[model samples]
Each structure stands twice: as structure tokens, then as C-alpha cells.
Target chain A: MRKIFVCLLVFAVVLSSVALAASSIEVWQIHSPIPEIMNAFDWAAQEFEAETGIKVNMVRIPTEDLHTKLVVSISAGQYPDLLIWNIRPGLEFQGLGVVEEVSSVIDEVGRDNFPTATLTMFQAPLGKQWEIPLFARLAGYHYWKDWLLDAGLDPNPTVLDDGSMVVNAYNTWDDVLETSKKLTKDLSGDGTIDQYGAGFQYNRKGFGDSAAYAFSVITTFGGHLFDSQTGEVVINSPQTVAAYQFMKDIYKSGVMPPGVVAWDGYDNNKYFMDRTVGFIVNSNSVISNVRENDPELADKIGVTIAPAHPETGLRTYSGSPDTMTIFKTDNTDSAKEFAKFLLKANTQVEMFKIMGVGYYGPLLLNVMADPFFSEIGEQERMFVENNKYFVGPEYPGVPSPELITVALAVYNGFVYDDALTRISVDDWSPEDAVKEIEKRVLEMLEER
Target chain B: MENHGGPRLTMMQKETRLGALLLMPAIIVMLIVIAYPFIYSIIISFLRWHAVYPDHPWVGFTNYIKVITDSRFPITLRNTAIYALVGTAGKMIIGMILALILNKQFWGRGVVRGLFILPWIIPMVSAATTWRWMFAEDGVVNFLLQRLNIISQPIIFLGDKQWALAAVLVVGIWKGYPLFMTMILAGLQNIPGELYEAAEVDGANGLQKFFYITIPSLRYVLITAIILSVIWTFNAFNVVWLMTKGGPSNSTHILNTLAYEYGFVGMRYDYAAALAVMTLAILAVFLYFFAKLQKVEE
Candidate 1:
């Protein structure tokens, strides 16, 4: 009897050990194509596992498949314990109520750790934090300094300490157009124009870059797709028409490459990197690519805030930051712990150092003061200074759950891009395109 | 009745029982994989099922009505029809010509046949990506056309609304003709050279022999090929989705890509489901008529 008791007791301990071993949490993150960025996440996961006895299983999903995968997983009642994605879709997930309210996580991480502007973008429906801001992705104009110098344009335009470019002929939209014409040339004298002055994707099928740039143009022109206070569909204003006209003018000016209407998210980067185009509105991915692959070209590349409105001198920079959220799972506590771990200043600094400053800007304010950021490059300074101008898709509107629906319309090629394509490719008048945009926005709003 | 442990069964009954037992696993799998999803999709089509929203209130027929009334629906449907019909027709014509040529005695016929199947053998995504580059404004297509003086200026093949669908169709035909060619070639081999020789002895010309004996012998094969090609071209999502993504003002959108846009991008699962059901219905009607025609032909 004593032998039997001993064996049962031993079995109980073994079973408990097995149970403890199984207490790992799963996290689904959109896979970055860059190896170092992915390795940084793996390192963080390993560190988290080392710190806590609980293991972290990091599942990397491609960006295109992530959204549908999340929806299917959640609907099938097999969602991960944690998810990291863009703040817009993160808010949409929160609005769906599958995510845990991470206000407590933010409190635990310390609300003051993150920048207020960046943090505010994630706090949908107000007074509640749905996700923790991971990193900021800021958009700007990436131009070749050598090309500018060759064209007799300012290689280094005066930027205010506040991160806004001083409005001048060199920085305004019209001035940029004039500069583009000067830079647009046939260096080979092959009886064909081998280079374009400027280019940005107007393709409706692009992954939100087109919409982001178009929205920046619209916002700079003093227009709002939705009223900030009322959340009404207001994309039919004269300013929107002017913005559409400006985009059409750019496409029609022979400055952009032929078929700008069909370029995808990567086309601008390809064009800029291959020296086919002198200037483009894009995120820092271009810089990161050049810095890693073509250092010579990287030295010649100049990063600045996107062009200001030729008339109003208003410059709006579209920002889509990566964010982390804890889903409502049995492993909520472990997920929350991992989120806090990711939000740590040292962890972020280490990760960003490996990821390179060109890929992501710091989310935590304290991390910005780290030597890693300070010594990075001039472009890093531009990224940090331009953070003040970072605005979500809900730029004119207050960030809310409704903003997700509005932003989805923009992201899904239903609104801004559709309007741009109508005016540029389909030959619809800007006013008519804006009217159709208004109608579509209203329909989507109604459905939402 | 036998006095065994239980009531004894007759031979037919035993055979029937064994047959059912053998089929049980397959039936269960079919139920799980096929029937459940089909029924679930049909049910979801009747509801308002946005992936993000919590409430999926049943608005019977509203989703379908909305799908029909949506402005993009007509355009997508028209585009799908043109893509299916024109793409299949092009594939059949090209495949028939190639199969006929390769059927004749020629040096390196085997090598030529192998080369013709390369497009079909290559993965669709890789082919689509390569074709996208080749169709670029400054790509090889324009370069070649300009060199030949066929056109003075470069045509943005995949970017122009007027040419996007046609470009997609060209890729579809190129990728698909191999299957038809192989099928028709097999059918040609089975035609028994005696028929062609008899037609020739009867003072029939080459076209006459082809039209009378060859075509008549290949009717079933051609019909089967056409049906398969139509289904494939109609449901083709990857090529169009990867190439243009139904862009240049959604000119290249087929039903499949549009359904993807609605379901995945727009998050309107109900509308997407409705579009899917409607597509199935349209294909079902076409197949039903095709079946009737096949019966009449028989």
C-alpha cells in the first residue's frame, strides 16, 4: 500500500510538470520580409520565455493573409492569445470585441512611456486603450539629392524645428512639379525619356499607400473625408476636388511614369531605386532598402516631410503605426506580460537597433533619447521631428471605432483610391469623382 | 433465420451492409468538408455577416438583393462573362491549331510539344508576375512592339482600362492552351488515321478532312476541354489578382476577385457569400444548359 501511494504521488507531480510546461502563449504577428526584424521578434520572445517560465510561440503570417487569417481564426474560436498589426485593423479588431481591453496593460506599462499622439491613435472610442503602440511608420518624400543638385533645386530645403517645411517655391507642390519637369530627362539621348520627374502610386489595388498619399494631399488641401466632430461623410468639398485635380495634374504632366495609375505598393520603391524616377512619396522602407543594399544611393537620398500644399502651405504626413493587442484568451495574463515586455524601453531600443532606424521609429519616448537613435543618421532626425505631423486615417475625425470603418473604406480601395482612379484613369471630372466618393463613403458609413 | 449469436442476414443483405460500411468514411468526410460549408455559406448569405461586427442579424434576401443592386456587380459580371467566353475561345482556337500541327509528321515534334506545355507547367503566380513585368510600360512587350513598328508609343497593357482585361485574357489563354492542346492531341491520336486517309481517298481537301472527319471525331474532347477551360478561366483569381488586382478602375475584375475584394478586403462576408452563391447559380445554369445540349447531341 505504501508503494502504491508513492507511485501515485510521483505521477501527480509529473502531471503537474506537464501542465506547467504547456502554459505557453501564442502570438500572431505580421511577418516582416526583413530577416533582422523577424529575428528581433524571435529574440524578444526568447527573452520573454527566459524571464518568465511560460514559453512564447511566435507565429509569423504574411501581411496580405493576416487579416483574413485573424477573422477566420476568431470566428472558428481558435484565435491566438496575442496579435500585432497596424493600428487601423487593430482598432477594427477591438471594435469587434474579440480583443481584451488593454487599458490595464497600458497602465502597467506606464501611460507616460509612449508618446501621447501615437498613443491617442490606438485609444478608440476614447478613454480606453485597446492596443499598445509598438512602432511608428512615418511617410515622407524620398528624393535623390544628387538629382536635385543636378536640376539646380535645393538639395536641403529649410525645415522648421517643428518638423514643418518652410513654404517656398522649392517645397511647394507647384515648385515640386517644376523641379520634376527639370529632372525629367533622357540622359542616354535615346530619343526617349528614360527618367521621370516624380511618381507616386495611384493604383486602386495598391496596399493603402495610394490612399495614404492621396489622403495626405486632401488633408493638406484643407479637406476632410469625415467631419472631426460629427463623423459625417464630407469628401465632396471643393478642397477634395482640388486635391483630386492636383493628383490628376501630376499624372497628366508627363512628370510621372506612364501607367502610374497601375503601380502597386512596391512600384514606387522600384522606380526610385532604379533611378527611373527622381522623387516619390513613400515610407522609410525605401531608405531601409537602399541603406541595406545600395549604400551609395542611400548617401544620395534625401528624406523630408511630404510636399506642402502649394496654396495653404499645409503639410500632412500620413502615419500607420504597428500596434500590439491582447486577445480575450485563456492566456490573457501571459499575453499581457508579453505586451509589457515588448513595451520596455531597453527591449524596444535593442529591437530597433537590430531592425535599423529606417524600418521603424521609436514608440516609447524614452527610447528616442537612447544613443542608438541619436547616432543613427540625419534621416532618423527627420523621422523623429516629423512624428508631430503623424496622423491616422481619421485625421480630420477623432480616433474612434467609427474611424476603423472609415479607414477600411480607404484601405480597401473603395474611397480615396477609387476617386483618384476615376479622375485619372476613367476621366471623370474631379467634382464628379468627389461626388461619387461622397456617395460611396455615405453608403459604407450606413452599412457600418 | 439462423440460430447464431444474432439474427442471420441473407447474402444480399450482408453485401449491402458491407457496401455501406465501406462507404461510411467517405460519406462522413463529404459531409464534413463539402456539405457543411455549402449549407453554412447558403445560410450566411441570408444574414448580415460582417466579420468585424458582432451581430449577424438575419436580413433574408437583403444581402443577395444588395449584391444584385450594387453598381460594381454588373461590371464584374460583364467582365467575368467576357473573360470566360473570350479566354476559352482563344484557348480552344490556339490549342486546336497547335494540336493539329503537332499531330502531323514533323521533325522535333516531341520537343515542340514539350515546349508548348511550359506555360501550363509553370506556377500561375510566377507566370502572372513574369507577365506583369513583361507588360509594363517600358517592358519587353512594348519594346518588341516598338521595334517592330507595330505601335509608335508604348501601351500600358495592364494599366489601361481598355487593355487590362484583354491583357489578362492573353495570359489566361497562354497558360490554358496547353491543357487543351494535350487533350485534343490525345483525342487526335485516338481518331484512327484510317478516317483521315478515307476522307483523303474520297477527294477531300485538307480543310475538308479536318472539318468533316477530324472535328467530328474530336467533338466530345473539344466539348470537355471547352467546359473545363470556361470553368477555369471564369474562376481564375490568382492571375488577375496578382497582375492588376482588378484595378485600372476595376476593369479587370472577375467574379472571383470581386468576391475576394468584398469578403477579405471589405470584410462584408455576407455580401461575399451572396456573390459566391450567385456565381454558383450562374455556373449551375450554364452547366444545366450544357448538359441538355450534350444529351441532345448524344
Candidate 2:
């Protein structure tokens, strides 16, 4: 009896030892303070752990504070096992060698699975193996199609039609101005305007949403900041001169609100949902939010293609890719394996569809092209299929994104100068704006 | 030998042991808290490191050189100087005047004293945010100014390059003056009434008493306050960063903001460490000169 008991105990000890031998994946994700997504992240980690017998940990920080926190912590030798950070910072992190390379995992994960929406980031700058893309974030207008018919610019053509609205696809700066002129009207027939055509922002800077969106309109007019490959800038080009000129013209034409320059999405969204503005240009996630926050507007709202390039039929919107980096390490084995798991087309589909409203588009081309993307409903398929190209602002003479950050800053700084604010719709020249942008950017670029 | 000194003291003289014993806990705490972080920061500054990264690289003085040559370097240094000089001087002047006023017995004296410290009591980031709201184009301050017919148009205080630094400096003075007032009040309370009594007995006037007695007596406190204020203001990034982010075209960026940007925003730890190292070097020189000056006062 004693011998049998001892054998059973010994067997139990061996079993426990084997269980302890398997490792846990200690991952740290930079968290935004959204409750729904936080819950989703927790659930996903649990499921991943249950499936693999690996422990998954997530450390989150506030979105506003993550940039500085990651920098200081990483600098101080306190980097987490794994973290999700903005892609721009990923570049700097790469330079510091704090991230592990996971090229094999990317190769194995089947790059073909990631959506076309996020391919640019997965490629990484200069084609270096550092991080896999975790999410793709983009923004645009969630408009009121019914209102467009009422405003008299719908595809069905809201001509001589009262109590209905439609808006034109913003083509030339002149076309947008003319549409806005018609859109900004006093329905009550009072002296004051009851509605406005467009909205803009002079405040709320972070990740450059306000400025970048506004600048995209400038870009749609054929304005550019830098050369893509040369790492040189032509910021002071003629294209940019026209962009600002259009802004001034719109203001003078009394289409957008006089206070539009000081208003961020907070004010703009309010004006939009209040049915006081013809359109609002902001994040894609805003479509879901409008429905949730103001269902009335949701019923009235419809998504549309971003403004097209004046000459080319090319449509453009800012693409910000969120990456999942295997931080730099000498041990390529586990890191590569982990990255491969994340890169799978199945995983990309899971990332988009499983998460809340699919704010993150898949990095795999197949997933982006797939109908089952997390947040994209059948209603938004046209936008997804036809208009999901990723493009960052170009630096004029230098073809580098790094230089573009500087040029954008300079242009935004002088955008509202009262002295030279002579903007006109037809004069929305990308060449002129680029020339003005170059003078300021070259000094910043040449600084060090 | 005298009988009192007959027994040779053990453990490095009896009186010195008492003093060492009294200070032992304090010294130990300082070693654990101050000395350790200083050493850790020094070691970290040498290595190219990130906490989340699987590996941290080692880069030497390259970070230091990079910070100096950065375009924002001189601008940051210059901005820091402006904030320190103007902010500290403004606090000193306001504090000195307020301390003199409060020195006299008055109605609601205690209430007035506490009220003056309201700015200091509020959390810095919260205070800065409130200031941002106040300085906003359509905020209460502009409304009030417009009502008073002070200006025809609202000024974009935080959005303009030329005005951002001046506005940040003003906010610093408002947030920091209460602390200065408290210190000056303490200094004022310490001055003996007998000195004023004696001065009055000798037919010395109010200005004479102030220049001869009050000025000399508080000189040490004034120097200490100035030194401390300069250091505090120079290292300050919370208020200015929260308020303007050295923006309106990098107009308000100071040394600490640069350190944060390079380290965190730029994600260049080596560069950040270099900026921090330069900050330390500058502070060390200031401390050395200050110590020398303080020794003369003693």
C-alpha cells in the first residue's frame, strides 16, 4: 500500500514540473481609455491564452500620455515584453534597437492575409523587419445623403426639389465653394445663417487629425510637401499656395462658420449632428459614434468617398497604421513565432471583425478586400473596396515622412495669418503652397 | 593631562558620534532615494534602451552631442532662461510686496493669506488646463476684456508664436507666487519687532528701516528663494507643455520639454539621455556657483 502511494505522488510531481516548464507570453499593450475596447482586449488575451496554454498580460496607458511614457520607460531600460505603440514612434524605437526583428514570423504569418489597407506599414520604412501592423486607422466624412438631396447636389440630382438635399463630390476648390455657398442657408429665413457647408479646426493637435484632414483637401488639389524617395523637401511649392488661398476664399464666401478655425471635431461634430453643417471631415470611427451618440444623425448620415484630386480621378485620405512590434531582441525564435501568429490572414480577419466595430482595418490585403472585415458593414463596402488606399503627406523636395512632419508643422503654424490671408477658390494652387512650405521646412530639415 | 580629557574617546571623538548618529537615518534615506536614481539615470543615459523592447542597445556620448546640435536646443535653453528669470523675479517682487502688506495686522488677514495660496493649492495640470480655457479665444477672459472694450478682436494667446512664451511666463507667475508669498511671509515673521522698535526710536523713517533692516535680514532667504525658484521654473514642463506644447511653431519649448520630446515623442532614448545629461551639467554648474555664493553669505 505504501509503495503504491509513493509512486502516485511521484507521478503527480512530474506532471506539475512539465506544466511549469511551458512559458507565458508576457505582452504589454499601450491601452487607450476606451472601456469597450479594453474589455475586448482582455477577452482576446484570455482566449489566446486558453487556446495556447500561454499566459498573456496587457499593460495599458492613456492614449494622450502613451507617447511620452513609452519613450521614457524605453530609454530607462524598462521596456515591456511586448507593446502596441503608434507607428511613427516605432521608427524611433527601431533606431534605438529596443525592438526585436520578426521577419520570419511576418513571412510565415502569410503577408497575403493582411488587408491592402495596412500593407504600407507592414512593409515598414526602408523595408526593415521590425514590427507587424496591429491595426489601420483612417478618417473621413460621415454625411447626410438625404440632406444632400435637400441641398440640391445628389446623384439623383436634388434640382428644384424642396424638403430634400444632396451634395456634390468636392471636385475643384471652386466646386466645393459653390456647393458650400448653396448649402449655408437660413431655413428659418432669418438674417442669421441656420446651417453651414463645411467645418475646420485651429485647435486640438495630436496625431495631426485636424490639420492633416484639412491638408488632404489641399493635397486633393494636387499639392505635395516632399519627394517620396529623395528625402528632400519642396515644401515651398505652388500647390500649397492655392490650398490656403482656397481656405481664405471659403471663409470670405461665408460658407463655413467664422469660428470654424477655432473649432475641433468636438464643435464640428456637434454642428454636424445638430444638422447645422453640410458635412464633417474626421475619423472613420465617427460613423459608429454618431449612431450611438445621436441616432437621429445616424439615420440621416451616409458615408461617401473623400474629395478627389482635381486633375486625376484619384481620391486621397490620411492613413495612420498601428503596428504590433516584436521589440528588438537577439532571440529571434519566440519573437518570430509570436509575430507569425499575429500575421496570419485568419488572425487579421479576427483582428478586424472580433474587435469593437473594426476600428482597426486588417494589414493583410485579403482581409481588407474580404467582405467580413470587423467594422465594415455592407453599407461601407464601396468605400472599403474603392477608396482604401494608404497615403501619408509627402515632403516636397525630400521624399521622407520624417521631413513631412516638419513641413506640416510650418504650414499649420502660418495657416491663419491675417496679413497674407488672400485665399481664393480657383487659386488653390498646390505649387504655391509647396513653395511657401519649403522655405520654412528647409530650415528645419537642414537644422541638424 | 586634564582629568576631563584623561580618557581618550573611542569611535572618532564622543561629540562627533552624537552628531553622526543623529544624521545617520537621513543620510541613509538620501543614499537610497537620491543617490540611487542619480546613478541609475547616469547608467541608463549611456545605453540606448527601451523598456518594452526585448533588447536595449548601448550608445555612448552620441546622445549628448545630438541634443546640443538639435535646432530646438538653443531655443529651449533660451526659453528656459526667460521663464526662470522673468518668472522668479516676478514672484519675488509680488511676494515681497504681499509679505510686507500681510505683516501688518488687518481684517481677514488669515483668510487673505490662504486665499493668496489658492493657485498653489490647485493641481498643476488642472490649473494649466483651466488657464488654457481662460486664454481660449471665446473664454471668459476675452469676454471680459471685450466687455471692458479693451480690444476690438480676441487674441489667439496660445495659438500665436510671438505671444505663447509671454503667456506661459504669466501663468507661471500666477501659479508660483503663492508659494513665494508663503516663504516671504515666513521670512517676515522671523524678523524681530525690537529691531523696528529700535529703528523708530532712532528717528529712522519707514523706507530707511526697510532698506537698512528688512533688506539685509532677508537677503539670505531671498537668495535661497531665487535659486530654488530658478531651478523649479527651469525644470517645469507640465504647465507649459500642457498649455502650449512649445507650439505656435516651437516658440515655447524649453529644456525639459525638449528632453521629453526627444526621449518620448521622438522615441530616441539616447538623444533624450543626452538632453538630460546636458540639463544636469547646466544645473551642476549653477549649483556650484550658488554654493560658493551661499558660503560667502554664511
Candidate number of the best lDDT = 1
Q: Which ten residues in a row have the lowest lDDT in candidate 2 chain B?
A: B48-57
The reply for model 1, stretches above 4 Å from the true place, is A1-22, A157-170, B1-8, B105-108
- The candidate that wins on TM-score is 1
Per-residue lDDT over A108-201 for candidate 1, one digit per residue giving the tens place of the 0 to 100 score: 8888877777677777777677778888765567788888888766787576666455323247778878888998898899778889989888
Per-residue error (Å), model 2, residue A135: 3.6
What are the per-residue Cα lDDT tens digits for candidate 2 across B96-160? Answer: 89889988999999999888889889998789878876876667877798889897677667765
Chain B TM-score of all predictions, in order?
0.95, 0.86
Give one digit per residue, the lDDT tens place, for model 1 in B1-298.
4586877799999999999999999999999999999999999999999888889989999999998998888999999999999999999999999998999899999999999999989998789878888998878999999999999889988778889999999998999999989999999999988887887788999889888988999999999998888788777899889888888788888999988888877888899899999998999899899989999989
Error of 2 at A432 (Å): 9.2
lDDT of candidates 1 onward, in order = 0.82, 0.63
Q: Provide the lDDT at B83 for model 2.
A: 89
Error of 2 at A57 (Å): 2.0
Among all windows of ten consecutive residues in candidate 1 chain A, which has the lowest summed lDDT? Answer: A161-170
**Model 2 agreement with the true structure over A1-448: per-residue lDDT tens digits:** 9999999999999887655434455555656434555565676666666766655667777566665666666656666556665434554456456767655666666756655434444334544556667655544555566656776666331211332122354544466667677778878984557688876653433335555555665566566666556655544445555656556666677777654433433556656766777766655555566767777666566655466555674456655566776665332344445545565556555555545443454445665566675445632542343235446544223334345345433443343221121132123344443454455456445533
Best by DockQ: 1
Assess every candidate by TM-score: 0.94, 0.73
